[model samples]
Target: MKNGEYFISKDKALLQTETIHQFLSRSYWANRRTLAQVQASIENSICYGVYHGTRQIGFARIITDWATMYYLCDVFIDEEYRGQGIGRRLVDLIVQSEELDGLTGVLGTKDAHGLYESFGFVRDPDRFMKRRPTNPWA
Candidate 1:
């Protein structure tokens, strides 16, 4: 998807691991994540990257079986590029994409609930639960 000079792509080869690591490493949820861990995660998930020319500026990933449900996570837009609708467009493409059609979606966010809510996500505290791993990196 193209928006003016910025475009979004699922081309994993175009993903800049270092740039992604830089963004994720500073993000509240993934601050403790290592570069190697980020790389492995990217390799396993469907990754969406936003770019201007060749410089990557945003990213989001979905863990899905492409059958039943999908978990959207690690979403971010470069601090310099936040108000540009890049994050929304990136997510719009993901949720509206044929790959995730008709499947249940889930995500966790301490903030940005409003953003996701616009895309049809609602608070489901009663049914939602989490169990952190004993090994922090596991």
Candidate 2:
């Protein structure tokens, strides 16, 4: 989808792996992820990349069953490109995509709740649960 000078696409082939690794490595959620891990994750998930002409400026991924549920993760817009509604459009496409519509969507965020909430995400602390990896570096 095109938005002004930016566009979003689900073509994994269009993703710039090095650029994505760079962005994710510094992210609060994926800070510990290695380049290989990021690559593996992208290969396994339905991926999206936001681009300006040719350079990728944003990314997101959805781990889903295509029928029941999907976990949205690794969502980010370049620090230089934020505040431009690029992230919003990237997510809007994912949530409303035919593959994800009608399925339960969940995400984890220490901040930026407002962003997701605007798209119908509600905090469910009581129902949410997680099991941390035993190896911190794993």
Candidate 1 clashing pairs? Answer: none
All candidates: TM-score: 0.95, 0.96
Q: What does the lDDT read for residue 58 in candidate 2?
A: 96
The C-alpha local distance difference test score for the whole of candidate 1 amounts to 0.92
lDDT of each: 0.92, 0.92
TM for candidate 1 is: 0.95
lDDT of 1 by residue, 38-136 (tens): 999999999999999999999999999878999999998888898878888888999899989999999999889999999999999999888877887
Clashes of each: 0, 0
Alpha-carbon shift of residue 27 in model 1 (angstroms)? 1.1
Model 1 bad stretches (over 4 Å): none
Error of 1 at 14 (Å): 0.5
Residue 134 of model 2: what lDDT? Answer: 95
Residue 63's C-alpha lDDT in candidate 2? 97
